[model samples]
Target: MRKITHKKAAAVAMAAALSAALLAGCGSTAATTDSVAESTSTAASESTAAESTEETADESTADEAAAKNCADLIDAIYVQERTADTDARCEAAKAAWDALTDTQKEMVEGENADPEYFGRDTGDASKDDPRNEDEIGENELLVVSFGTSFNDSRVADIKGIEDALQAAYPDWSVRRAFTAQIIINHVQARDGEKIDNMQQALDRAVANGVKNLIVQPTHLMHGAEYDEMCEAVDEYKDKFESVSIAEPLLGEVGSDASVINADKEAVAAAITAEAVKTAGYDDAAAAAADGTAFVFMGHGTSHTAKVSYSQMQTTMQTLGYDNVFIGTVEGEPEDTACEAVIEKVKEAGYTKVVLRPLMVVAGDHANNDMAGSDDDSWLSQFKAAGCFDSVDTQIAGLGEIADIQQLYVDHTKAAMEALNG
Candidate 1:
């Protein structure tokens, strides 16, 4: 969880050293000033104020330096053993891993139980190996996801989920499938990589002699995209001597109350805890206090966006955050739902609240819509309702957060276990 690279660590060290120097210089000046001013005027009060400011500044500087140390993965290689051509990257990645501690290395090379599968124990080049095809057994697992659009971001979200599933089922040969039509199309169009369709990805595995295919979607919930994936998978279910496509993320069986609670807690903590720490909301204890409200803005879809937003609303209530509310730029559980929140704040008399995004990335909605304070934005409307003098906003998206993605990983593990059973 705590990730750092050499370069990042060095940068942080340099920053901390600089901050230390500044603080020491300030300390020297204060010593001189305090000694001189003790008999002149209100030296104790000035000294107290300086000490508090210094403490606050030290904490802020530490946080900023730590944030800077989160390592840019642009230089790191992922997707090892993907195919024959992938060997160079694979080797580089292995070397990179060899240099890291066990924990740091796990971030690169997966921590899967290393359950030997039927496939060849090969590196990135094995995709082209005929012998590699001979290596796979019939009982194999394939994990599908939206395949992150951000090249670097993909390493954790999709790949991390795949690794966890592999660790859970040590015997199953696990693979990855991305349902991100737009993203895959872009990758294929801009880059010359031969991206596979759902059927094509399946066929590739089948051609490699993979049997007992277990296709599991890593989506957040069931919707059109999930249904479409099932359609693609069913067309080839008969191709395998034995095949069963597992449920999508939050599949029907996963909707139980306990599971839902775990998911909601993970989601809420994933999105908000970092925010509360990152923004120093500790001083705003009153905001998290009872009767205090928080508005979450979800990206509304023309078709099935309501499903995610509505479920998210229920999840918030289940978390015991009664003042929590969800609204979208489109669809029912409409903006009027936000209006109702304003009415509540007006009546029950809460003066301040926080706004956050309920989508993957803050990209456009969080910036231009929810917190923009534009007449059309939700915060602007809340302001008009006289709910509070100020409304703070967090641009963090649930998908961008690693812990939230683990929830998807958790779903994948459950579904794979079911298929294994």
Candidate 2:
């Protein structure tokens, strides 16, 4: 059925009124000439008013159609892979968005586009580098990450790692790539900052005639993202003479809960120490003695490597971080859920809780899922559990810590050494 929009309804009403006036005029045979003239004048005035109303409605309908078209354009480009038409599509979407009036822009909506699609103020995007420039030498260090749309976190965490790698390996050209193309499209659409995806970054290196390529992923574990990064590098391995991929922040995923490695131990110590110092405590034991527990939230997964989260918990326990706990947003292992962690903290008789993200960048999970005021967020869940005297949050990512950055540097160094060897 054809939907009758408001403008269509108004047009239909105007046409019906015109038909009625014509019928009344044709049936008025008893009226005098003077009365006929007066009636004709009144009819002419009504017709003019109807035409004016129709024009306004038509304009409004056109504006709405334009805004919807722009939204659809944005939705089309919000994809994981960049195609041959991606550049043209991006240009078209930006043009349409710019042409919209302030009011029309607000009306824009799509599967992934909204007013916040281009209007949200994350931070000054200019402060951070996209690092997509060309004219690179043979050796290229491609830093890959899951990526974040939060501008400040991107600068402080992701860019922080890239800068450190550039300084450590002055001979290699450091470039950036984000695994999430949705974030890539978002940053481009919102801030005009064009970040390369894995394919683009790799292709860039191949095109620039880079002989050696090193991929350093800022991921915390050998989970889905890390596996995907490895697959991407395999596709481009033949392009470079020597291609090496570094270990993720957490080195390896052990078979079961009983396995823990040096990488996990370092992360456990570093994050706990940072959290303790930030919370104004001397150490984890001191915090525990004071009836405070620190919970680290990770982005859980359904993959078999979800054991990494469990191993992290075990490593904390083995390190004697009795006050530290591990939790996941997805609750993959059933024991790492927010509710489960709360129960553990309560059982341990800790009346105070501090929550922080174990992820590289304190992006959406850290800002919204971990510390947001929503009822389902970790912060709200802990407070509503009524098991703590206070529930505080530390809105910092692991990448911001000097020790965490050094871990990536160390991993990159290992990869470089292996490539040389």
Candidate 3:
């Protein structure tokens, strides 16, 4: 079939599967499994098409269903809702979501649009005082987000983080800024969200009579985006006279331990608590017993901080999840990382496998690359190798992480401080 356009690629990949399977017979499922194998959030457009999000009313449980190899081993990742009584469906769903890659979550979050993403409106956000003549006050926070095309989800994911921060520091006034221009226009056109530009957000902060400009980015890591944000902060450095950028959610300076700890805690408290349990399962033991290997797809970066993925994997293993492994789309644990995992499962005599993404959204990669039924996907290759029996998956994403979300809150809190200081 002819290649799809950039805009439609992500939305239609899986939908194309029917056609792909019909024309190619799912052979090896190889041609472009890599096509869907996007491992980074920024590159999600290159990830899988819309993921398969479903809920099978007939399946007894994900475990039972997968035990029966209830699926074809071609493509990867399908976030579906199942009514089966498998341990704790809620927990399972939570685990499924936590397992998404950063890229997956971003693609999903991208669904949010202008005013649709956020609640606040820009009734009159124009900067009457075009110049910054007034003294920048303290007790101010600056929320920096990658910005989204989908207003509603963007409000929840990024702005929600800001709101959390605002709540934490009730004394400080929070001003929002969109690092993306398209998103700003979108807000103005749709929801009347009044953020004009970095200048406007700053003017609003000054108008609020705040000084401290605590800048926090809702980015997954420290890379070009983070760097640009830093630069942006510097550009406005003299204006505030007091500014500091907070650590990114998944950055080198960010507390990986805290992030992962939040992950474990979120899983323990989620609806699927029964399956994963408060006392997480023994990774090596589970791997040995089930003859199953677990692979996590992370939203990795190409920056020097990319090593964080390896560190995260090490941290998970340190948590005694010997069978639990982490890989990224942009950095370490490249595609071949799965080869080692496949080897381990083979050595354990397990013919089947379970693959999940460790992300905030069940977007492109999570659905098509990691779990689609196409031949070239991770699921396809594992099945082809003959050691993978079944792959059970979900798409709950990481939006549920209280601490991760709190990270955003913290940034805003700090930003508020910068504004008011």
- On TM-score, the leading prediction is 2
Q: By descending TM-score, how would the candidates be arranged?
A: 2, 1, 3
Query: What tens digits encode model 2's per-residue C-alpha lDDT throughout 1-421?
Result: 1223544555565566555555676455554444545655665566566667767887799888988999999899889888888777888888998899998988998888787777767778899999999999999999999999899999999999999999999999999999998888878877788999998898899899999999999998888889999998999888889989999998989899999999999999999999999999999989988998999999999999899999999999999998999999999889999888999999989999999998999888999899998999999999999768999999888998989999999999999998988
Q: Which stretches of candidate 3 lie over 4 Å from their true place?
A: 1-138, 147-156, 178-209, 250-293, 331-354, 360-362, 371-385, 407-421
Candidate 3 lDDT, 170-241, residue by residue in tens = 765556666665444434333334453565666676676565667767666676767877876677677655
Clashing pairs in 1: 81-123, 81-124, 83-124, 83-125, 84-125, 118-135, 118-136, 119-135, 119-136, 138-211
**What count of clashes does model 1 give?**
10
Which scores better on lDDT, 1 or 2?
A: 2
Model 2: worst 10 consecutive residues (lDDT sum): 1-10
**Where's the lowest-lDDT run of ten residues in candidate 3?**
70-79
After superposing candidate 2 on the true structure, give the runs of residues whose Cα lies further than 4 Å from its correct spot: 1-67, 100-106
lDDT digits (tens) for residues 1-421 of candidate 1: 1122433544554455455555555467767455444423333454455566667777666544432221112122222213343434434433433344433322331232111111112123212111113356666677766553333334434555556666766777777666654444333322323345475578778777876677767665566667778888878877876666655443442343233545655676566565555556552344456334567776565444345556666666676655566676663555425676577556656666678876554544676688775797877888787648667787655655667656665665665566557
**Model 2 lDDT, full chain set:** 0.89
Task: Judge candidate 2 at residue 400 and give its lDDT.
Answer: 87
